[model samples]
Target: MIIRIIDGITEFTGKLCAWTLFAVGFFITFEVLMRYVFNAPTIWVDEISRVLQVWVVYLGAAYVLKHREMVTIDVLLSNPNSVWRRLAETLAIIVLFIFAGTACYFGFQLWLKATMAGHTTDTYLAPPKMITHAPVWVGSALLMLQGAAQLYRVWAEPLPSDDVMGGAH
Candidate 1:
C-alpha cells in the first residue's frame, strides 16, 4: 500500500517534470524569435527558463530513483539469488538513504537560512532564493521516502530473476 502510494506520487511528479521540458523549449524558442524577428527581447525568459530547467532536473530525481532508471554497473549483480548481489544491493540502498537524507537535511537548512535572510536573485524580477531551492529540498525528501520504500520492498518481497529488469518481469 505504501509503495503504491509512493509510486503514484513519483509517477505524477515525473509527468509534471516531463511537461516542464516542453515549457522550457517553448520559452527559449519564443525568446529567440522575439529577439531576432520582432527585435524585442524579454528579460524574464532566460532566468525563468533556467529556473524551470533546474526544477525539471531536480524534481525528476525521485522519479528516476523510484523507477530504478539511474545508471548502474550491473554486470556483476546479474544473478538475483546470489549472496553478493543481495549484499551489493543492500549497500547501495544504505548509501542512497544516507545521501538522500543528508541532502534533505542540509537543503532544508540552507533554504531556511535563505528565507530568514530574505535572499533573492539579483535579477529585476528578484524571486526568493528559497523558492529556487525548494525543489532541491522536495526532491531530496522524495528520494529519501522512495529509498525507504525500496529498502522495505527488497527485504519483504522476493528478489527478481536475472531476466527481470527495472521491476518488470
Candidate 2:
C-alpha cells in the first residue's frame, strides 16, 4: 500500500514535470514574438522559464528513480546467481539514501532560510527565493521517500528474477 502510494505520487509529479515542457515552449515563443514583433522583451520570461526547467528536471528525477529508469553501471553485479548481487544492490540503495537524505535536509534548510530572510531575486519580477528553492527541497524529499520505498522493497520483499541486478532483466 505504501509503495503504491509512493509510486502514484512519483507518477503524478512526473506528469506535472512533463507538462512543464509545454510551458517552457510557450514562454519561449511568447518571449520571441514579443521581442521581435513589438520590440518589447519581458524581463521575467527567461527567469521564469529557467525556474520551470529546473523544477521539471529535479521533480522528474524521483520519477526516474521510482521506475528504475536512471542510469546505473552494473557490470560487477551482472551475475544474477551471485549472492553478492543483493549486497551490491543494498549498498547502492544506502548510497542513494545518504545522498538524497542529505540533499533533502540541506535543501529544506536553504528554503527555510530564504523564506525567513525574505530573499527575492534582483530582477524586475523579484519573486521570492522560496519559489526557486522549494522545488529542490520538495524534489529531494520525494527522492528520499522513493529511496526509502526502494530500500523496503529490497529488504522486505522477495526479489523478482528479472530484478536481480537492481533493474529489469
Q: Per-model C-alpha lDDT, please?
A: 0.83, 0.83
lDDT by residue for model 2 (68-138), tens: 77676667776544568677777888898788788888989999999999999888889999999988879
Return the lDDT, model 1, position 165. 51
Given candidate 2, what's the lDDT at residue 149?
Answer: 85
Clashing pairs in 1: none
On TM-score, the leading prediction is: 1
Query: Mind giving the per-residue lDDT tens digits that candidate 1 earns over 49-138?
Result: 888888888789888877777766768788776778777778898898888788888889999999999999999989999889887788
Q: Where does candidate 2 have its weakest 10-residue lDDT segment?
A: 160-169
Q: Rate residue 76 of model 2 by lDDT.
A: 75
